[model samples]
Each structure stands twice: as C-alpha cells, then as structure tokens.
Target: MFTPVRRRGTEILDDPNADAALSLRSLRDIALANRFFGGKRAVVREVATLLRRHSGGNEPVSLLDIGTGLGDIPAAAARMAGRRGLVMRTIGLERAPMLAAAAATRCTDALAADAMHLPFADRSIDIITISQVLHHFEDAEASQLLQECTRVARMGVVVGDLRRSWLAVAGLWSSSYLLGFHPVSRHDGMLSVLRGYTEPELRSLIERATGCHAGVTHRLGFRITAVWSPRYRRA
Candidate 1:
C-alpha cells in the first residue's frame, strides 16, 4: 500500500528518485526499447488526438515537453505533425545537464532548465506535456511546476503518468524479476508507483494550484492523464 502525503489539504504522494536511480546507459536503452515497443508512441498519439480535437487540425503547432529525458515524446510529435505538412517546433526541457546533452544529440532542440522556473516566456507555447515526470517532485514543488506549466502554455497542458495501484506495483515487480530489468530500473519503478498520484488527487492539485478548471482522465490502459486550459482568454 502506498502512503499519501497531505499538502494544502490535498493528498500528494512522495517523490521518486528515478533520475538518480537510472544510469545514462540504462536510460538510453530503456528509451530506445520504449520507442520500439510503442510505449512512448502511445503517449504521443494521445497528445495528437487531443491537439487535433482541440485545435481543429491546425498547422504549425509548437510544443514544449517538460522532463523529456530522451526526447521521445517530442520526437514522436514532430513526426506526427510532419505528416500534415505542419511545422512542429518542439523544445524539450531536462534538469540534468548530461541528460539534456544526450537528448540534444537526439533531439537537437532540447534545453536544460528547471520545471519550476522554466526559461520560456509567458503564454508562448501552444502545448506543454509532462510524461512520467511529475512523480519526482514533492507536492508543493509539483503544484508550483503545474502553475508554471499553465503560465507558459497558450492552449493547454497534457500530463501522462503511471497510476498508483496494486496492479501497477505487481506488474513492476513481475517485470523486474522476470524480464531481467536493471536493478535501478526495477527499484525506481516500484518507487515511482509509490510516488504516483491518483486521478482525483491530481485534479484537485491542479485546480487549486493553477486556479484553472481542468479535466482528468485515464489512458493507455493504466496511465492517468489530465488537461488544463486557461480560465480566461489571454491577449
């Protein structure tokens, strides 16, 4: 069972040490495997679906992906947008300089920046994505980061992450023992579940932090996702 931490009257989970746990080599390998197996692809597809529905298949979309470790999500978005002759400019942000450097080699447009204090101007980006990244922040920091995500994004924000449940925990354990995953990956996966947020909890956090009405939903079989838009029209 996962213990929840309460912050500002909301039950927030703990933070996971996934970035510290996974080595660069292992991170890269896992990213590659995820791309090959459509793990990241599914995430991008959902984002694309949201974009098409909300933007009415608009051209020339811009995206900012937060905590984009290996740039897989942005890269996939770039590819999908390219099919429509829409110029997709994606900027991936990571905290680790080494991880940012590695992603730059793969993405050529990634930046090293803090999520709590993003370097971008206000309302400059069409979409912001946080995929499997929020579990690393404490409740207060995560709330602040979500506020920043809302501040910078012009259209909306999309968050995709693991759901904290017994099934997820059991799957991680089984994968660790049977699938020959790296020790760090196994340990971190379990820790991530413990640190993950439930649907109502995340919705409450976003609404309270950003002061924006948002909708939360589930996707990809076992992941929780949310989308938030500005409360008022922005000039």
Candidate 2:
C-alpha cells in the first residue's frame, strides 16, 4: 500500500472551472463535516477567547473570516460574543462568488476576494480567523497567507486546520462516508488532511510569518489551532 505524502493536491472545489452546483454541494458537505467533527468548536473556542480578552471596549469588534465557506462558524462566534454584550461585525471573504452570496446572509458583510491580497487596509480588523484553508497551498504560499492575516488583524488571529497523519485521514474518510458527504467532498477532504500540518510545523510556520510566538494546540478530531497577536514581538 502506498502511503499518502504531504505534498499538496488540488481539491475539486479549488478548481475555478469546477461545476457550480457540485461545488456548492461540496462546500455544504464540508460545512456539515465541520459541524459534526471538532472543526467548528475549535475555531469558535479560539475566536471567543480572543473576543473576550479584547472586547472590553464599548466599540463593536470586527472579525474577518477568510474562505468562510458557508459562513456558519463565524456566525456562531458572533452570537457567542453578543451574549457577552460585545457586538461583533462579521466579514466573510470567499474567492467564489456563489459561496460569497450564500455567506452574506449569515454575516454582517460578505465579499468575494482572495485571501493573499485582502481588500482591507493593514491592521484594520479587530480579529481574523481562518479555518481549513491553508492546506490548499504550498509552504511558501501558506507562510505568505499567514503574513496577510497578521497584517490585517489588529487584535489577534486564530487558525484552525487539520493534523496530517494516516490515522486521521482514515478516520475522516470513514466518517465522511457514513455521514453521506458528497463524493467530491470525501475525496477533497482526504487530500486536505494529506496536506495538513503537524503541531511543530504549524508553530514554526506562524513564528516565521509573524516574528512572534503563537499558541498552537491540538483539538479533538485531528484539529489543530494557532492563536497569536501581531503586536507581540520577540525580545
């Protein structure tokens, strides 16, 4: 049996020429997986913590989620902040126009844009969160994406991604089948996990990108999270 290598492979949804309806279904399936698995909880947990620590001021907090898929995760995080009396302005950014349209209803704002060159000015948003979007790129592009996140995020950035391991890949593949995920999504997810980062690799990548240490931790269901502030500098 051939072991899956860490090299990146293109997911069907990543292709610009992918069928519209298929892509939408694939996105929906991915969102469903996040709900059942620990992906949603991991991101909301980190974003909620960041919001609490920085949301003391009366001003509304701003949050931008790159590759916001269906926009459900940030919507949930925003509601959580509302419960604490902090108004959260959620921005959903997606490269796909169709996905952006669906996300707009769930967020304070939504736009179709590339994450590599964010439309917002530097350090403009209060918080930035990216989930399961990095693995689509190579190390250089991934590092650059992190720089963009740190550049735009004023308060902090939270990253939620998969942990690369054959065991994890197998678990998700089986779970996806039992959950009746779109066939394209199951294949795409397998590639995503193969492209995922280990704990130390993700930490080192963030440190290299931001020139500051990050808090990287493992969550349930092969998820890993990294949180860091752009203001922090290494002594």
In order, what lDDT does every prediction score? Answer: 0.71, 0.88
Per-candidate clashes come to 0, 0
lDDT of 2 by residue, 1-235 (tens): 3445686678878888889889888878878888988898999999878876784578999999999988988898898998988888999999978889988988999999889999989889999999999888888898899999999999999999998889888998899889998888999999899989888889998998779789999999889999999999577
Q: After superposition, how far is residue 211 of candidate 2 from its true place, in Å?
A: 0.8
- Candidate 1 segments exceeding 4 Å error: 1-22, 29-42, 53-59, 177-179, 231-235
In order of appearance, the predictions have TM-scores of 0.81, 0.95
Q: For residue 153, give model 2's deviation from the true position in Å.
A: 0.6
Which residue segments of model 2 deviate by more than 4 Å? Answer: 1-5
Local error of candidate 2 at residue 9 (angstroms): 1.8
Error of 2 at 189 (Å): 0.4
Residue-level lDDT tens digits of model 1 in 1-235: 6534422221121223435435564565457535543457656766676566445455567889887777878888888877866677788888777668767755638888878898989988888998877767777988999989988998878887767777777766775556566765666666666677788888887888888876787655356777877644233
RMSD of each: 4.8, 1.9
